[model samples]
Target: MTGLRVSVGDVVDFGAASGDRNPLHLDREFALRSAYGRPVAHGALATIVALGLAADREELARVVELSVDFDQPVLPGLTYRVRRSPRGVEVRLGELRVLTARWTLADRAADTAPAAPAARGAGADRPGPPPLPDGGGPRVLGLAELAGLVDESYAYRVDSAALAELLSRGAAAGVPDALTGPLAWASFHTGMRTPGRDGLLVGIRLRLTGARERPAEVWSCRAEPPLVHRRTGMVTVHAELDGAASATLTLVSLLRRQVAAPTLVETLGTLPRSNALAGRTVAVIGGGRGLGAALSCSLAGQGARVLAVSSTPATALTREASAERLPIEPLTCDARDPEALTTAFSGVALDGLVLAAAPRILSLPVAAATVPECVDHVADAARLVLAPLAAAHELLAERAFVVFVSSSAVLEPPAAWPHYAAAKAAIEGLAGHLARHRPGLRVVVARPPRMWTEMTNGPAGAAGATPVGVVAGAVVRHLLSGPAASGRPDVLGPDALSGP
Candidate 1:
């Protein structure tokens, strides 16, 4: 990383390039009334500066984790020094720290490597604006459309014009400048315009310089030619309004696409319930709420004696069980505590096992996370999967089924989710290993995408999340169907529940 002198003109240009219409950087009136008292460079601009400095040295095409804090404002016409940090980089204004950031490097391939394709973050480090409905605005950028414009770059202005219609429409629809859908495209397309192998935005961390907000009516956005490296590339963009930097973005781009190996789950349509599970004993860990609750009900309905395991039994689960006239026994246990789990499942001959417990997610950036903290997080989740397998794997009825409710996040690592994803990935691996080694046991892994559960009711959870019943049904379907002859454990992807 290197120190660089920045000008007010640089600030304005950044706003235009990143299409961050926030008035705090471009509108003097807005800044005067706000806490800053004057226009301040976007805090993300410092992040861009740090990223650009990193690109000069390391091949950071796929950043695993990024953390940035805006301690002070970086005003226009000031010089800032960017220096290396234990994690990533930091920006300073003389003695005051303007912004500090740390980044965890993704394992780069020896050759041109693809970025992590499944690297979607849960609103932790994504570029602003948020995803919004189309709302009859100008066409949004799509992958197919980006392919056609291989060498071309499109510029967007903030005024009420065809090029910037999306912004204007978003503003009219009460969309915040940072959360405007078009603005998201503006930041992402910067990578598409850069000439090189495509990459995804695996991670980002941005902080506002001041309380200033709003965007200038007139704006400019442009993507610089990507700085291509042997294994990675960096795409820089600057957005400006009225000759001031509103936002600057530097994207980590890899040279190839990432593809994961296929799991055991078949993508066939939903299979009907049968008496296959009748007169059998089953247990559902973390079955008090969300998909776990749903699975408990479904298993009970299928005539399995359901043991709904949770820290405490929820009223909803009890009510559902009673209403459905299904037999469900609530078992209290903390999976993280081995003694508690042992007591809860002692002497239980499980015919089917559903392990779906998880720990409280800190969701901290990798930079701030300690090794012990990460280990503990993974261990907590592991207990849910391992505890049941350990307790009942040998004692289960012949031809019994064991299902670990995994997450699809393992396929596409989400930002700030390394702990959770790692645990799920490990579970999947363990399930596969058990299936291959233990011929008599039916091990099934369910990699459900974001489900409409209480834990995932946020912005990311609101869209594309399958119903809880769908997740539970898919799990039971695989259990009833017996072990696949493919010599691999079934991995139920989200699509497994797409049908009736």
Candidate 2:
């Protein structure tokens, strides 16, 4: 908190000097006809005070840009504290009560210079600061950089007067002390607030274009009405930025800090929605580790309720994965054990089943220690999920999608190992048989040559493999497109791959 005070006269002088001579302020007679019935300070005035605090605190003293979201009007004389940030500062009143300011500072020394003190009232004689910055200051804001500064124009046709008011002045709500706890209510909305999620919000990213710093103060933040659907709540936020690049980045960073579980609501309001995967429950049999984790996360993100099953009550890989808050629910079931696996997924009515968990089927040299261990790792994982889906025909919700993950190793088996090749062949056979017999369920198989998933890339990612996201994306396409038009098993091998 930086101690910066602005007397009422200072607020008036700041507004007057800035060339904003709105009738509500400069004329007492004009103000008498207003709704507040008196002159009120400009919302930008509070932003200026906050920027001064940031200037006092940070290395950059000259503010390049500032944005502010006004809450209730600040009548003359009531004070505000300057909340300082690394990029700039905010002028705040009360608790984390309505957001008050966002400001960004930069080295504008090249753009602005002190005057030589005019010889009388010849303020007009003084020149506007020295010319051009490339020869002086930057002539063009970088295309990429200027993109960060665009204030996203808003659209709200619900009310004309309200829209006009919003365009002129932004509004904000006070945030609760614990943004991670529950909703933060204000008198304006009658105890309205966003529901707090159990996990951390992690970070707040501005869905803005290009590169931009998050400004400390945002002008014209409105307390938007909550858009609720299916018992879920969302709030739409529209914030303005000061300058382009740094301001966008700085302000976004600050918003990320302030937003956590409790206060971070899904900001996407009622935009158009498509039922791309409607009535689908994707099942991941070997979801405990590696590629399995990748598939589960991908499917879940696409609006599928993922049924993540792994063979162990706890595997080293699964335990680490359990801690991650993903769209899928991680459950234990040994892929090798059929009954335990059946019990694990008995409750789930699945739509798609992805077999990502493959046992370690690496082939060590013939003379190497414990060859059996290598076969079990890759081979067993394939069998585990395949057997149960075969028996419990009821688990799938009729006309389901089944995807099996295979490897390119079988086509070009490493000279050092042969067992891994055999297991993968058997896995492919299982998928083929299922696809042939089950006309109702669409069976899909993807044989990735080398994916960055744990299949090729270990936890540390020492082994170079194709990026998991790209591989997963390919798999997703297969799931959506369904069986090939040729109707043959989907076979991917080393020869089909283009890049290393």
Candidate 3:
């Protein structure tokens, strides 16, 4: 398998075919704020592609059981490869494994029973129920309603030739034409009908029971009541399809965890108002969201004219700044592009500079990390500061302060985040070098503990994390009123928050 990439157009087509229009897969802005950090291809889409690749070696008609475990998200625009595994096949984005699959072949021939027609309702063509509430509660649905959920686009009018044509051009190839319809229906039933929006598919087990020579004109699917485990947030849905072919599917999914945004009022109220940073102008890179936004707000509260530079437009922050009469100007620019950074800060002379931009953290083991992944992290980290630093060189006031927002993980590296730890460590070294070479500059490296932000909103990521405002307040105080510059980088740890 080679030359396989999931484009935005492919995602749209998949959404129409499967009726799964989850924002995580379709909406760029929504996905930018989500845990994955960008639009990711559907897990079912990945699974089907893997199966199609496997069909090259094995016969699909002889396969009795197929199981797939989704390990990591399959991001769009990346080429993936399929390799034979001890189980069956594994999909890889470079050396990192994204999905694992196992296939079981039947000893005898497949059953040749006449497939039963599915039960239909008068309102079968109507839209199904809405997604679960945002507040997080149980949604009750009768089993019949779940069974009768119909996909208007591709369920009744499945085109095996079209599916085969689509799969043949990508990394997915060699899928038997007869198996395309059943495989697609399995994806549609799991993604759109049963668990719906909140579901994060963990694994899927598909069993082919009967064989059909041609694709069905009208395929009907029936699903049983989903078995949900409240404590583990796991849901299992069993579904049976009857058409030209008959198959049974068992889908295991986990409900996605969501963290509530902290109240801005409460966060601001915790800090005392002071004019210590009065008349100072500070440029905060990546100030549109996460800790950068919190730092911008805190700095503005302390009477500094803050330039909130971010890749995306900071609409909400801009509105808040205006309503509060705060001197926080939002500037949109990509930190990777030096020209853009220079243009965004054309006339601004900064009294202080904060390097707070960072890429979305991924939990990839060092052994599994590819060359591109490592280089990308290091490059991103370097660009975030290097570009802004170069652009602000002539614009800096005499003896201006510079702050680098390093992470505590640099010292106590997480086993799963070697790339992140290495990148942070590299920048900290750069900060030290700058302090040594530029004697007049006040350099500070602030290593804060994990803070509650969009980057760390996942359950495991949020554990033991400090509030973003608290950390931002401490950073602001240290920058303005802490000890004078020591000529070397002043490395501040979590203990710095205990100071006056």
RMSDs, each prediction? 17.0, 23.3, 6.8
Show where candidate 2 strays beyond 4 Å: 1-275, 312-326, 366-382, 453-463, 482-488, 492-500
Estimate, for each residue in 143-214, the C-alpha lDDT of model 1 and write its tens digit: 333334333334443321221232222122222232121234443343233322133233333221211133
**lDDT of every predicted structure (CA atoms):** 0.54, 0.42, 0.70
Best by lDDT: 3
How many clashing residue pairs appear in each of the predictions shown? 30, 45, 0
- Assess the local accuracy of residue 385 in candidate 2 as a C-alpha lDDT between 0 and 100: 53
TM-score of each: 0.47, 0.40, 0.78
Segments of candidate 1 deviating more than 4 angstroms? 1-275, 368-370, 482-487
lDDT (Cα, 0-100) at 180 in candidate 2: 6
| Model 2 Cα lDDT, one tens digit per residue, 78-129 | 4445665554455544342323444343344323221111122334332222
